[model samples]
Target chain A: MKRIAYPAAIQALIGELKRLPGIGPRSAERIALWMLQSRDARPLEVSRVIREVQESIHACPRCGFFTTDTLCEICADTTRDAAQICVVEQPTDILPLERTGVFLGRYHALGGRISPLDHVGPEELRIDALIERIKAEAPSEIILALGSDVEGEATANYLATLLRELPVTVTRLAQGLPAGGGLEQADELTLSRALAGRTAVKG
Target chain B: MKRIAYPAAIQALIGELKRLPGIGPRSAERIALWMLQSRDARPLEVSRVIREVQESIHACPRCGFFTTDTLCEICADTTRDAAQICVVEQPTDILPLERTGVFLGRYHALGGRISPLDHVGPEELRIDALIERIKAEAPSEIILALGSDVEGEATANYLATLLRELPVTVTRLAQGLPAGGGLEQADELTLSRALAGRTAVKG
Candidate 1:
């Protein structure tokens, strides 16, 4: 069916909006129309912000998290434990860990995991930078906070072997039943891990 | 707990993105980060389109649908039925009716309905413009294709009473059980409307 052709600019706006993750054609249209018609709508403000982010925001050279500064805020802070580094798959993952207040150390974004099907290897990631940081800082421990997927496991194993010569303790996030998870709802692998890694209750 | 401070531009982008319907803080962050980091992401293109839409698109002089031209495409089209105009609460509604291929007539967007709580009265809508168009064009029929809500009913009734003086047939979209709707799932009012509005299946 031939589409009801919106104005050239409206159509262009819709097409551009649809490029965002999870935004489909209907959602794109709704957003475009809302931006155009609503009295209180601030399309200009949105546009300005988009342009500013494009011009200013970039990956931190040292840690790979987003920042407009020469060095990201986390990297610039002297209070964080420089002797421990947490490795993650993407820069976005840093927030949830930070919110938990569990790790007071620095971060290293791998950019991606080793996915053979997608032709992504360690060379494509920030592994070399991580190694350089490890060598320079000589961190006491390196926490692999990557996902539990097959690719994450492969990348972790590869990194472990490569860093064997370095004088640092290597560890991974524990695999078991997640917090607030039910035994009945837990998958077989998680159940088995929980059983194998169980600890005695304290008095 | 204190939030991880994103760059001024990045935080501003996320906040602006959250203004769009259905986009929350988490989704906003995800989209902003994706725009900043992804190799194929087109923040510039999106920014350009938004600016163009904001600068160019406006209400068409004749029919009130959005257009960059002096007149909307539908109003400019010489082939459409000039004697029949479909009245809608908003410009966005015109597309779905056009997609059905059931209405080849032009459209008149009222811009809004009469909502007392929101302080929107008949004066706020394009009712006067609609009346003027009806007088000038002498349309044979005016179809009210507003929503099935209370405001829609009130607006339709008000329009119908006001249009009683004119020599034209005024009708509304039929309300009944929707296409492919099941009797078990339909509400009481819908079932009753369907029963009352029933017609014999044609051969």
Candidate 2:
């Protein structure tokens, strides 16, 4: 017997859903079927919202965070500490740090890190924009909140070297045991880093 | 510090994405961001395809499978066996069986099985339609390809009882250790069923 197939429209929907980060073929198909069958037309609403976001949202010129207006909310806020700027690899990373409520300063999204294998170098990233912002704003401290991975470390090192001539103090997030995490669950590299970066406790 | 939030359009997109089956808050945010940032405008195409599908596709009046036309491809095909109808719980279930290429018979989707906890009853399913099809077509066999869960069993039993008056042989998919599944992995119930339903080796 000839193989059965989904209608052309459904097939197209599945094809598009599969392009998302984590969705696979089976998941795409399942989501497509749900979109076609769900009672409330939620997928249609999602599609509309996607279009709206695409049309309205753009990267902030200074910081690279998503924004509808001239600058992102963080950049637009006058109350934030202009003397400090936290650097991260991507725009998505800003929210987690913001949620911590410890950092009341502005953020600079690198857009991506230096990965030679992927042909992503300093030129491809928002490094030039970040440097220009640093020069103009004259922040007292620049904190690097990038990942511990090889690519993140390389990018951080490259940025640190470039910013060394500047007047601002360059710092990186501390590598140590995560809060609420036990030492037993820590990897060897993490344990070593925690030991090397151990802070003196004051009574 | 005030909590940082996504732009209204992005937040709305995330909310709509969260309504999909497997998408959670973080995944929704990721997808929404991707939709906003992706260079090719794929998500926009997906939205258009979803609207197209909603406008064109409907459950086939005969077999209940999704179709752009009056009848689904399966029901419209003249070469398929009309005398042997396979009964399944959902239209989605038909695709997997169809891919197996073993069964040449047309299918009847019951939409869902009897689930008292969820307030779904026999009346909620397509049992009446199956019976009507049986009476009209006078099919020689009705294959119950529903799940092995309690609701599926109850539904199968109910359908069997309902269709007993009609001149049709109602058979169910066999219960045994799944193909490629080992004895050690098989559950006790499955083991017992496998033993009881052991077939004779003709070779």
Best by TM-score: 1
Give residue B10's error in model 2 in angstroms.
2.4
lDDT of 1 by residue, B47-76 (tens): 888888888888998888988889888998
After superposing candidate 2 on the true structure, give the runs of residues whose Cα lies further than 4 Å from its correct spot: A180-203, B180-203
Candidate 1's C-alpha runs over 4 A off are: A1-3, A195-203, B1-3, B182-184, B191-203
| Native contacts conserved, per model | 0.71, 0.73
- Candidate 2 has a DockQ of 0.59
Highest lDDT model number: 2
Candidate 1 has a DockQ of: 0.59
Deviation of model 2 at A92, angstroms: 1.4
lDDT, candidate 2, B1-203, per-residue tens: 46788888888888988888888898888888778668786877878887888888899988889999999999999999998999999898999999999999999999999999999998998888888899898899999999998998999999999888989999999999999999999999999989998999999
Report the C-alpha lDDT of model 2 over A1-203, residue by residue, as the tens digit.
57899998889989988989888898888899998778786766777887788788989988989899999999999999999999999898898999898999999999989999999999999998888999999999999999999999999999999999999999999999999899899999999999999999997
For candidate 1, the TM-score is 0.91
